[model samples]
Target: MTDAAAPTPSNVVFVGAVATASVLLSAALACATPFAALAALSVIALPRPQALLAVGTAWLLNQIVGFGLLGYPADVVTLGWGLAIGGAALLAVPAADMAGRQAPVARTLAGLLGAFAAYEAALALAALALPGSAGAYAPAVVVRLFLINLATLAAALALRALAETLVHRHARAA
Candidate 1:
C-alpha cells in the first residue's frame, strides 16, 4: 500500500483563510447593491436559470431585511420598487438575447432602449390609473421615472454584453 500524504498545516490554514475571505467578500458585495451583485453573477457566466435564481434570492433577502429591520411602510415601497426594477430587467432579457447576434453596439443599444420604453410605458399607465395624491400623478415624475428606468435598463444590458464577451474570451482561450 502506498503511504498516505498528510495535509500540511500551512496549506490547511491558507485554504481556510481563502474560504473565509470569499464568503465575507460575497456577503459584502451582495449587500452593497442589487445591481452590483447581479452584475457579478453575469461576470461569472451563470446560466439563465442560475442567474434568475441569484436575482430571486437577492430580492427575497432584501425584502426580509427591509421589512424586519426597517419600517413596514418603507419595506412595502422597497418591495414595489424591487418588483418594478426586476420586472424591467426580466423583460429586457429576451430582447437582448435576440439582438445579441447582430452588430454588438447597435443591437444592444436598440434592445435596451426598446425594453426601457416598454417598461416605462407600462409604469406610466399604471401610475396614471392609481388614485393617490396629485403630486404622485405629476408629469415630471413620470418623465423622470422613465428616464431613470431607461438608464438602469441600459446599464444592465451593458453588463450582460460584457459578460457575454468575457464568456466568449474564456471559451476561446480554453
Candidate 2:
C-alpha cells in the first residue's frame, strides 16, 4: 500500500490564524473608514472581471457591515448614500487605470473632483429629503462630505502607490 502524508499541524494552525486575523482586521478597518476599506478591496491590479467582482463583493460586504454597526440611518438612506459614494468612487477607477496611458495627473485630478462633487450632491439630496434638516445644514454637510471624499481619495492614492511599489519590488526581485 502506498503511504499517505498527513497534513502538518503547524501549517493548518498558521493558515487558520492568518485567515482569522485577516477577517478581523478587515472588519475593523472597514468599520473605521468604509471608503478606504472599499478602495483597498478593489482589484484594479488584476485584469480580470471576476477579480473585480470579487473585490467589489468584499467592498459591498464591508459597507453593509459598517452601515449595520455604525450610525447609518434606514435601509433607504444607507442605500442612497452607498449608491452615491460608490458611483463616485467608481469614476476614479477608470481614470486610475488609464493613468499609464498618457499624462494622467490632470485626468486623475478631474476624476477625483468629479467624484467628490457627485458624492456631495448625493449627500445633499439625501439630507434635503430628511425631515427637520435645515437649509443651512446643506452647506455644512456638503463641506463635510467633500472633506471625507478627499480623505478617501488620499487613502486610495496612498494604497495604490504602496501596492505599485510592492509589485515593482517583487518584479525586481524576480
Candidate 3:
C-alpha cells in the first residue's frame, strides 16, 4: 500500500485520464460508466492509494456529468441510486486489489472479474432497496454491462501498454 496522500506523476496522469474518460463514457453510454473496468485498471496499474483515488475520481466525475450536465432527476430515488453506484465503485477498488494479489500471472483479468462481481453485488443490494432498479439487473442487461466493462478494460490496458512502449522507445533514442 502506497502513501494515501502522495501521488506520483504517473499516478496523477492515470487519475486524470480515468476522470476524463468517466465523463466521456457517461456521455456515450448514458448510465454505464464502466466503474468495474476503471477499478480493475486502477488496481493493476497503480499503487493502492492511487487506485482508490483513481476510481473515486472517476465516480465523482460520472456523478457530476450525470446530475449537472445530463439532468438526472433530483428526487430521492435518483439520489439513492447515485449513492449506491458511488459506493459500489469505491468497493470495487479493494475487491480488485485483493483478487489481483491472489493471481500473479492473470492479475488484470482476476482484478476485472473481481471488481465486476463486487460492483454488481453492491448494485444488486441497492436494487433491492430502490424501486424500478430491478430491470437493470436482468440477465441480458447484466451481460451487456459486463461486456462493456470488459471492453473498456481491454482498451485501457492496450492504451497503457502503447504509451509505455512509446516512452521506452523515446528514452532509448535519447
Best by lDDT: 3
Candidate achieving the largest TM-score: 3
lDDT of 3 at 144: 97
Model 3: weakest 10-residue lDDT segment is 98-107
Off by more than 4 A, model 2: 1-59, 71-102, 132-140
- Candidate 2 per-residue C-alpha lDDT over 43-113 given as tens digits, one digit per residue, 9 for 90 to 100: 23333243234334544554666566554666775566566445534443443344333344554455455
In candidate 1, what are the lDDT values of residues 1-174, reduced to their tens digit?
122233345434433432343243334433223232232322233334443444444445554554554433564444566565456444434433444445656654555455445545544454454433246437796555445444544555665579679989999999
lDDT score at residue 142, model 1, on the 0-100 scale: 51
Model 3, 1-174: lDDT tens digits are 346557878878888999888989988887888999999988877887888888888888888888999999989998899899999999999988887455554888888888999999999999889986757878999999999999999898889889999999999999
Q: How close to the true structure is residue 11 of candidate 1, measured as C-alpha lDDT?
A: 32
Order of the predicted models by lDDT, top scorer first:
3, 2, 1
- Candidate 3's TM-score reads 0.93
Winner by TM-score between candidate 2 and candidate 1 = 2
lDDT of candidate 3 at residue 93, scale 0 to 100: 94
